[model samples]
Target: MMTMHPQTPDILPRVAFVATGGTIAGTMTEDSKTSWAYSSAQRSGESLVMGIPGLLRRAQWHFEQPYSIGSQNLELGHMLQLRAVLLRLLESPEIDSIIVTHGTDTMEDMLYFLHLTVPSHALGKPVLFTGSMLPSDHEQADGPGNISGAFEFLIQCLSTNADVSGHSAMPFGLCMQGLFTPAHRVEKQSTAGLDAFDGPYSVLANTQWLLSRNALEMSEDSGVQGQFASLFDPTATRHPLFEAMEVPVVFCTPGNGPLRQLTDLLNRKPASVVVAAPGHGNIPEACVPVLRRLLLNGVSVVRASRVIAGGVEQGGEFDALDAFRQAPVQGGNAVFSEAGGLNLSKCVMYERLRVLAHSLSV
Candidate 1:
């Protein structure tokens, strides 16, 4: 049997806390309005440890970046920078774990991105992502508790070398909401509840590593890693010289003018368009003509719902099939192009286009 070494001074785990401003570092005013307002009076990431005395006493702490921003402001570039930083830290022989203090609003999206970007071989150290729904300045803030929990979790993860293989096998990506995987699979159980991430799968019991090294090795050998990397590198400049493909996203609102404006935008940019239907991917009949014009101009129009819970249904009440056929008929396009479902889909499509472009160039 392999003997596990006890954590002591000789084997003390070093932890890096990367704080990229979120509610975790946000300030609340005396009026009780939660805001992303930063105050010089507020404690910094380094001060967080002092704020919660005795927390993380055994571990060495390092803060990557201080000053919090709302998660809504997080972008792809930020994700890239964070990944590069994490990779750099992972290369360090002393660092044993990493904790990211993020805002809960878009934490899952960021976590999934990190999940895809961080290499498994370089991921031996524990990487715990945590945040609180309440601001740190709130009188009844959960930030302190959550941060404490995250630190404890990281220590435990490093001590045990928990198995993360399951995470690696996920076909889509991991979405951690209050400690639940595929966070979309779980719904927020309570409005201000501590166990907001409660799901049917009993997530609290399954603290094992989401993905294993062996699985990553197999996937890497199969070239999946390379393919995924190529798909995600949006800065790739090479492209095939072919008929332009434009995708348009039309946001349907109470007024018909928004759709018309979108159509006008689509006309200006000669590419396929994906209409972000207001409800169940439904567009107003008044806006149908705008879509029709784009189709007439050879632009492919796809339907995507703005609703976050459910996806766009095919051959549904919206006459989606006919509309698609009337258009140039490219596949579905995402309404938003950020690091969510839409971005993930776009990444896959872009990868295919890149491969085709490379083939054509050859």
Candidate 2:
């Protein structure tokens, strides 16, 4: 643990910053090694902090770069590894806050994963996730301002133990552009704008944002059945990417042509299947038989919408399909529990954690 001093500089909060490569660390290059426009993770976390005007003296910092690849290249294993890093950092008493700089493309996945895996009681301090749409070298890059907002939010959380509006905030949140939103309610609104999110209603850091559903439904609980309260366990051996690709997500497209075949499930039934069903989670009637067979054989299924904003409804298209009673996996205790009111992307994450947690203890 880093010891605190009673002097002037030491009074600034101590921060643990993890830089997982995203556009915020990107740089333009002619090489074909990186994704889309430029090479991400071209810059290091320490360099990002040191280059930011007036940020060098704000805090005592510890930096680590777990990946420098683009966000599209980041996989499930990376998230689990990052979770382990966060748990380790949370153990240090001298650390007042933690921040992760990532790519905006999948920033919500990182944020929501932390929200689900790390509960309030486990948080002695707090963690913030931030990233930008444009590369760090862009003339009007948003990464620096976003990162600055992270530090400002940390100062308030440490000093007042409350948000800018003087209300308590959740342990996991995202600070970006000019807004601060608790992790659970965050959403990316556009790909073209700097202030591209659609939650939180403030210019300064705050968590008074509203949610569409009951608070109780948005679980901060760990794996299924309290499974030791969280998957953020730093000590347990991990199955980071264990069978991550097996839980197939089938998309519901227009027209009733033969849907994608699931003959593979008959031989090696996945623990779960997340269907990105058409409008309001209407699972096409054609695929019903195979799904039912899988269900009886101990495979789980979740119905979700492909639409960006709305959620799938109960009794959507088929009454029988809408109601799900799942069974445990063949050899593992994980269950891809039925849930509602989450977008398709979020549903994928929710089920992944549910089914994956038991493979290796969460």
TM-score, every prediction: 0.66, 0.81
RMSD (CA, angstroms), candidate 2: 4.9
Instruction: Give a tens-digit lDDT track for model 1, residues 211-249.
Output: 432332321111232233433333322223221333345
Model 1 spans with C-alpha error above 4 angstroms:
1-6, 33-42, 119-122, 164-202, 205-228, 231-249, 267-274, 284-289, 292-302, 318-362
Worst 10 residues of 2 by lDDT: 220-229
lDDT of 1: 0.53
Q: Give the lowest summed-lDDT range of ten residues in model 1.
A: 218-227
Evaluated with lDDT, which candidate comes out highest?
A: 2
User: How many clashes does each candidate structure show, in the order listed?
Assistant: 19, 0
Q: What is the C-alpha RMSD of each candidate to the true structure, in Å?
A: 7.4, 4.9
